[model samples]
Target: MSLKSLGAKIFAKIVFNRIQKWATNPVETQQKVFEKLISEAKNTVLGKDHDFENITSFEDFAAKVPIRDYEELKPYVERVVSGEENILWPGKPLYFAKTSGTTSGAKYIPLTKESMPHHIEAARNAILCYIKETGKADFVDGKMIFLQGSPEMQEKNGIKVGRLSGIVAHYVPAYLQKNRLPSWETNCIEDWETKVDAIVEETKNENMSVISGIPSWVQMYFERLQKSSGKKVGDLFKNFNLFIYGGVNFEPYRAKFENLIGRKVDSIELFPASEGFFAFQDSQKEKGMLLLLNSGIFYEFVEATTFFDKNPKRLTIGEVEIGVNYVMIISTNAGLWAYNLGDTVQFTSTKPYRVIVSGRIKHFISAFGEHVIGKEVEEAMNKAISKFNFSITEFTVAPQITPSEENLPYHEWLVEFDNSPENLQKIAEFLDLEMQQQNSYYFDLIEGKVLQPLKITSLKKDSFQEFMKSEGKLGGQNKVPRLSNDRKIAVALIQIQPQN
Candidate 1:
């Protein structure tokens, strides 16, 4: 083994030894973490404003600090951006993760010096933990292509500001830099379409052993590389063995990915957002990600069903139950206190505090009161894919209201196919049937003629990618919403569809 690979294996062994016990007793681990975070932040301006000194326990903390969204926290964040020190954390944050805000225009999430290591550590522990469980570490010896956002950071009030991926790219450890692909100059290109081409050219002939990115973007890169090299991914990169993805559900795109790779490789899912890196798939044996309880963040959950209510019940890790969706509430060392990140997740295991991201609390389609969500759409899509044996490259759903007396209201689907079954109508029917099975309200609407069966708009290939490119949202953690109550996204998709 080369020195770098040998070093990686040794470090992985150390991380595994450190995090193994914490995963077994996550609840206890989180409690201590929560108390420590409070103590760390209790002297800051935000803590002083909220009287954090008097808060002694989780219940006390919850009672003192009201749950806040971006709008509510904007003032404090702005102050930090304007060079205020000790306003949130002990000092000004090192950087801000500017997110593509669906609800608010663009949100700047703080990343303090104290919390930066947590972000790095959580990601490192994920890979290390996976290596420990699977005993696969030689991939570290070959090149790893990390498809990330542009590294061209912008300055705001003397602090660096950029996408979380871009910011994290700067911190990739020096030891692994030798085997990393796509030179830094190429990564600094702001335009994704341009950047992807540069990435493809730089790494096409390299011995890539690991690849990581959001699935859809990675799929695009895979297609480009395959087309250019005229080889399946497995053929192009013989040593490729690990795939790490996050930012969207991977199930709907799994079949397409498997087809492109031409072989099965180990995969890991992570739950990293601009807010924080919360969890990662620790073992191939389990479906859920082991929550990072010892990280510099404290987590709480409110039953998603009751999330909009005034003063909903906030449950700690110890109180969360399996199978119930909960809106995540987080207190982080990055200076956010009891902030609602708007993500909904369901616990799969309470003992180790493992969870599966269900959907976004803001991203649901209830235009006609049927209350369809991302999870339901994903389930229906999964079922249809299983029943029909077809593959989807990308898809999004929106409500199409009746245009007057002539047209009928229906659900509109804009789907880009990697491999389509011959009978499009049969596939559409199966999808509608699965939606009805998953949601009775939707079934009742269709049965009562309140809504027509979902209309399938088969997009010509590359339409989705073009749409994102045109919208300047083409790469790195950006995702097409799975369900929207309005036809804005659907109309845009159609407008950008490739002309036959």
Candidate 2:
């Protein structure tokens, strides 16, 4: 190993040891974090509004501060946006991470000085954990590139504002700056297509060892690289061994990525949002991400099934169980109190409190009482793909409630395939079988003839891309939802182009 790699290995050992402390004392660490968040923010606007001074226990905190999504939390966020000090946290934030919201248009999430370290450190330690486990830090000597939003900033009330990825681009640790690829000018190109073109030109011949981004966007870059160099991405960047991704489930895209790169690379999964960086895949052999209990965020879990019910019970770290799907609610140092981030997660390992993002609370199909989640569908899709060795570019599922009188209503799958399967009906049957195996309710629905086997509609090439482009979200952090309860996205896809 080189001097740098040796140094990284030593540093990785230190971080790994530190992380082990909380792995054993997960609940205790979280309780301490909870107390700190409450005590520190007791004087802030949200803290005062929620009677934080009187809050003593988790139950008290839950009772006083009701879980609020972006819309409910908007009034206070607006105050902070208008240059109000101590509105959420102790003072005005250092940055506002501008993100596209669902109910509200654009959400400006705070990034306080106190909270920023978690985001940065969690990501760093994830790599350190890998280095410690595998004894592979040679990638540190080579080029690294992150496919992300522009680094350009727009000021909002004296506070800097940009996409979270864009804001993070400005803070690439000093050590990695030398190894980081894609020049500042290339990253600053705002238009997605133009920026990608610039990135391809700049990094095509570079010694790239690490490539990180959302899967779909990175696929585009890989394709572009392949086209330009007439070689698989793996061949071009032979040293490229680490793939880091966040935002969406990577299982469905794994096959396509494997084909693009011509080989498999070790991957690290991250659970990060504008609110906070919650978890990261710490062990190569582990099933789920190791939740950051000692981070500035205090987490709560409401069972996803009862999330919409009147007064859903919130569970603390000690109260959680393995395999239970929960809507992850968080109160963070960023001053987001009892915030519902919309993402639903399942606890895979309670010992260290590891979680897998199952789906979004607002994004599931329950039209026929056979509630289907994103994780189930993605797993079923992967199963079917693996069985058939088929090439799927992108796909989504929605309920076909009103079908022709001849057929029962079913789940409609719109698939964009890189290489269309010869036996579409067989693949559909396989997908349906896998889905039934995964979800018992779906099994009942199929057995009772409440719904027919899922129907697959092969979409024209680039259908998903066209839909995203039409929605003004062709690139950056934007992603097509894997499953939608409604036909909004399906209808929009239909309007965009032809389907088979």
Candidate 3:
């Protein structure tokens, strides 16, 4: 290993050791660490601007600031892009991370030097914690294949501007820079259609140990590899060690991957975005634990019960409870104060802050006025599939409303399964029953004939990956949207009638 890699390895070891000690301590110790970090962040803000000096405690800080969404920051982003200093921060942000907004087309989120460190540190700490928990650091001798978005810089008006992906890739430790599979500068995000093919070609011969990306893209790559090599995914990735996936749900794709690889690959969920690398899989055994980047951003959780209310109550890490969903709000070092990221999560446990992503606030189905979020659908589906002793390989749900007088709305399930179809109808009946049990509103609407029956389409084994690839969203960071509420789009693509 080169000097920088050796230094990074040593630094990682020290950090991992410290985290291990911290992990074993009482819950109060972790809270104290969070408290100290919150105080430091408050102090830093106060020192930079006199306006923030009035902030006293975490609660005070949260109460005094109003929650902000991405739309509210557009003007400030525009000003920064125009080369203005001190609009959002003291200086121009290092680079803008390009992200797709659910409603808006695309957004360039600015990440300053102060903010970039947080992203880097969160990712590093996640890796270190994983290594500490699993004791598999020594096994990572082969190249770490981050099936990441392209690192191409976008040019506007004769000026070449780097996106956050490009910027982060540019700043990666110099030692491991040469070892990166695709040359950073050549991997263009705008050219994903072409780059994905190149990515498969480039990594075909390399001994890849750790493969990290969104489950959708990885699934696509696996499918392509299977076809191109005329071999199963197990043959192509026989030497692969661990699979670290993020950006979307992996539960649906889990069985297919495991079966294809012929080995139980160690998997972890990463809660990261273009904005910043936030929480990650803190422990392999526990459901995704939220390791608060104490140094990066101060976090607040709005109680799920009161999130839609005008005066919702916000809770800190200490005040949060298990089994309750909350909307995450953060005040980051990047100058975004009390920003609502639109995602929803539920805490599985509080001591270590284990959270499972519930769904995005905007990404829900309200067809026939029966509100259904991603989590509820997933749970219902899980229950239904478990009854048949068969596992779901991949699935997506879309709301469907027939044009009849009832104007009813129901769900269309596009599912891929590995087992025999002898009990397919039984599976559908169980799914419908589970939906009725979980969602009262859905039951009422369906019984009243205001909603149609739930429909299921059993795909041709490995067709979901093909469908995603055809859309040109076939790599890291992108995933098959689990739920689409829009009626027009749903009708055009997915077949509503249940297959025999």
Candidate 4:
């Protein structure tokens, strides 16, 4: 390693030591640390500015600031794109992280100097914690492949502006910069259309040890690797040690990933967004325990019960409870306050603050006027599949509304399975029964004649790839959207005939 790499290593060690000290502290101490950080943040943002005087306490700051979504930040984003000083931050944003949103077409989220350090810290803490648990840090020494977005810059009037991935690549530690498997500048081949081909070509020869990306993209890459080599993916990346994923849950694709790799790969979950890296799986031993970056952003949880009742109570980190779901709200250093991030999560424990991602607040089905969340669907499916002694490779549940007299909505399950089971009907019935048991709203709708019975379609193993390709969203950060709850999108997707 170079001198810069050595310095980074030393810095990482010091940071890791501090995090360990914090992790072992009492809840009271941790809370006090967070309280002080909140106070400092409030002072930093509101102190120098005349317009921000009303923001005195954290509660006052939250109450006074109107919640903002990505759309409201678009004008500031445009300013960053033009390299102008934006209202949200003091200086010009260092880079823009391009990401797509459900309603917003494509967003360019600003990553100011103040915000970048948080991302680095979150990433480092995650790494350090993984090492602490596994007693292995050199596992990353080999060729580590990241199925990242293309770093090609977009042009405005023939002048090239840097892409989000390019900016991240540029800013990473110089040691890491040297050891990056595919040189970002050269590896990220231009044109979104050719991304898969480029990725496959670049990774063919390397002894890739660790891989990171969204689950869907990694699955697609594995499939392509198998097809090209005429061998299983395990044969391709024989030296692979770990799999780090984010952007979506790995439940649906778990079996496929294990089967492809021929080993139980160590995995890490990241709750990263275009705006910031919010949370990460701190310990490898704990699957979904999210360690919140206490110093990065202040978090608030809207009580799940109140939300369903149409009256929500927002609670801070100090007030969160175990096993209760909540909508995530965040106030970040980058000028967003009490912003509803639209994701839902449930705390599994609060002593160290562990959480399981429940679903997106907007991505739940309200067919028959009774709401059902993505977590419910996942639970029902998992229980049902376990009962059948067969594992599901991939699946999606779409709510279909009938055009007949009743005009009722019914669920259609599209599943991909490894085994061609003799009793498919039994599996279907079990899944249907489990759904009713798990989601009372679903049961009530069916019993009241407001919704019809569940339907199942066994998809060919390669069907998801074809669907993704047809949509021009083949690889990198894209996933097969589970529980397409919206009436129109669900209808359109279910109506598509499976390719022969």
* Candidate 1 TM-score over all chains jointly: 0.95
Compared with the true structure, what per-residue lDDT tens digits does model 3 show for residues 1-500? 54544555677678877665644553455356445434444444322443355555655656666677889767666766777666655556677777666667777777777778867676667777677667666435566667776666775433335545566666666555655666554476456556666777777777766777777667667766666777666567566877877777777667668766767878778887766676788788888656563545667789765788998887776778787778888766565667788888888876656788888876778766777778888887767655666766577788766545765556888777776467777777778878888888888887887777687867666466556555555554666667778754355345433456
Clash number by candidate, in order:
0, 0, 1, 0
TM-score of each: 0.95, 0.98, 0.84, 0.85
Candidate 1: tens digits of C-alpha lDDT, residues 1-500: 77766677788888887877887887788889888888888888898999989988888988899999888988888788888888888888899999866667888999998889988888878888877877788998889988998877899988999989889999998877998878999988887878888998999899999999999999989989899899999999999999999989999998888888899888999999888899999889987898888888899999987888987999898888998889999999899989999889988887678899988888888888787878889988888888888899999999888656777698988888875568888888888988998888899999998998987888888888888878888887788888888888888888876566
lDDT of candidate 3 at residue 293, scale 0 to 100: 38
Of 1 and 2, which scores higher on TM-score? Answer: 2
TM-score ranking, best first: 2, 1, 4, 3
Regions more than 4 Å wrong, model 3: 1-13, 20-51, 155-163, 383-394, 403-408, 416-422, 443-453, 458-476, 495-500
- Compared with the true structure, model 3 gives a TM-score of 0.84
RMSD of each: 1.9, 1.1, 4.4, 4.1
* Better candidate number, 1 or 2, judged by lDDT: 2
Residues forming the 10-long window of minimal summed lDDT in candidate 3 = 42-51
Indicate the residue-level lDDT of 494 in model 4. 49
Q: Score candidate 4 by TM-score against the native.
A: 0.85
**Candidate 2, overall lDDT?**
0.92
Distance from true position, residue 16, model 4, in Å? 4.2
Q: Which candidate, 2 or 4, has the higher TM-score? A: 2
Q: Give the lDDT of residue 287 in candidate 2.
A: 96
